[model samples]
Target: MGVTDEVLTEEHKIEIRRYFYNHQNADGGWGLHIEGHSVMFCTVLTYVSLRLLGESSADGDGAMRNARSWIIDRGGATFIPSWGKFWLSVLGVYEWDGNNPLLPELWLLPYILPIHPGHWNSARDQCAKEDLYFPHTRVHEILSSSLHNVVEPLLKKWPLSKLRDRALTMVMDHIHHEDTSTHYLCLGPLNKVLNMICCWVENPNSKAVKCHLARIKDYLWVAEDGMKMKGYNGTQLWDTAFSVQAIVASNLPNEYGRS
Candidate 1:
């Protein structure tokens, strides 16, 4: 894991490409999950991912072209959800100003505060219609509007701006603590990736980034379809328990052990 060479081999690339192609929806787009309906969020993300993997827009038997068409027909990548916008911004495809500020300063507030950013709330209700399962309430809209229009500007002022820097330092401290405690695996794949991004942003050549890079393979798994990112680092204990229960319930393990 300490090796400095590229981790993903050509074979790994081929398998990952196969995994994307294997799970492509009939409409030539992708979904948030393997079995989900094609939505702008996942479709755009998948299309960009394949492009990053060196697939031409005309590749995939025109699957990439169809994906572009699907996105255009649904008002382009602008219709993608907030998470999509964030990643696209990170990838340099979308402008950072387009995204609602996910203030790290929120983390400095008391945990008991009801207005914490961790609450299940959308800062902007502009997701694609397909991904908009829950519409924003009037109260939510008002609060978000106030935050964006009033509170955000005030926070940028001289006195409060000082707090922003302090808040960011505290946020990075928490991220470092989480990474060290989890041995660089973090809580889940999403957080793991986010923490790695944070670590790289803080210092690209730092040991924290190296450790995170070393653990990238922990989330990858291969199946009949191809290589895919697993939902968690590992579930070996859970899988073992489930398998043993199933075998015991069938009485096959007991009967077959003698053979």
Candidate 2:
């Protein structure tokens, strides 16, 4: 869990944006976890976060599109890192062909199973018990921004009834920070896809943002392969492993370093 604030004032957002611009690695990079190699999640997400804070992606502020290209070239959200793949797969952006076949079989296991997050988080109360009562971990509050009231419900980002009117609104605002600017429409689903739709719909500008959505929707066909992606990149490891495995499985072997 990284820093989770109820709200980041515009001034604070600007200051943080300045920090990312000034403190980014001298190599014109930022690594995963502030220590590891640069990754799609760190590069794209952080760079976008900076931009949302009002940093420019152009040459004058910093070439954030360079980072976006890193993610795009490697493949966008689909090819980010291991966790990225898992989530992308879960979110239906990637196929499970290369995954290690997570033993959700464990869900069927007897109570004695040892490797569960349930077992690992010894310091915390039983997740099952806690969830039974509380059911979710999201921290939300009353919001005053236009994002919470206007954008959230329009996009249908979360279970609206479950959320306070304020919380649902907040979700749209956060997603809007990136979606409104990035021209990204990766996570396709009835509701999430609506966010992209709304961005274009709501853009009162030159109608340019609407075109971005039009382009993304160009590859929206479904199939028996079960909505397989054209070439979405979920996690860095997920994409790399998938490519490597396909090559090896084809019996045309080659040496590639596996992270």
Candidate 3:
């Protein structure tokens, strides 16, 4: 039977999503499959995912609470990098200002604006980035006008609101699917907010919003470190590794030699 059939409860969704989030490294992101080192790839997408589910930046959890600070550091959503800016844009939260200078009038200027390498950093890094987690942006198209290697797919015709709607939808679907897949242990607080965001973004006045909002009760998690992502996950491997390295520097590695 599917996991959906076995435990499929709201509580379970909370669990898995939290795993993905707490396991996420700093920068407010998650690793791919929850096994890799953290990168902005997981951070930006997961941040939005959690918010949409039902968890708010105001959540008592450290990971969930620090989201906006992460986003605004690049300048209140105005100065986030291209892909980072896109995620914010897709959520309908980013401002049109500070966007790469997209002169629609250039289309009428009769000369295609040449995309110069001078403005971008590490195109390889940009290309390697996982678009699925980031979502597509119109700002990218405005600058390049070519999709030769765009990280994420562009919404048909590049309609801002439509693309925004779709991005919002994907996160919501993820929350439902996450809950169904994990029996509602909670897909981490991020997914909780992701579920909340989906309903709010798509149909703010619908029952889904109310339901997600109410589900907030299940998302609260308490920890010795002043409330954090629930069941944050295994740290023995990482912590032990650090401890060993520290002992080695102190010439204590020989102590284990006797064993």
RMSD of each: 11.0, 25.5, 16.7
For residues 1-259, what per-residue lDDT tens digits would candidate 1 score against the true structure? 1232267776777788889889989887788899999999999998898887778889988888888999998899989999999999988999999998878999889867987767544435668889888988899989988998788898889899998889889999999999999999988899999999999999999999999988989888888998988899777778989988888899889665844
Best by TM-score: 1
TM-score of each: 0.52, 0.33, 0.32
Q: How big is the RMSD of model 1?
A: 11.0
Task: Estimate candidate 3's alpha-carbon lDDT, on a 0 to 1 scale.
Answer: 0.58
- For candidate 2, the per-residue lDDT at 200 reads 54
lDDT of each: 0.87, 0.55, 0.58
Model 2 Cα shift for residue 221 (angstroms): 49
Q: Kindly give the stretch of ten consecutive residues in candidate 3 with the minimal lDDT sum.
A: 224-233
- Candidate 3 local lDDT, 1-259, one digit each (tens): 1334343355545654565565655665455654676455456676766665557777736777566666555454444458777667766778656467665565555343464324343353354345557645778645554444452455444565587677767867776676556444454566656666765677789766666555554545644322334432335667889988888899998888844
On lDDT, the stronger of 1 and 3 is 1
Evaluate model 1: give its TM-score.
0.52
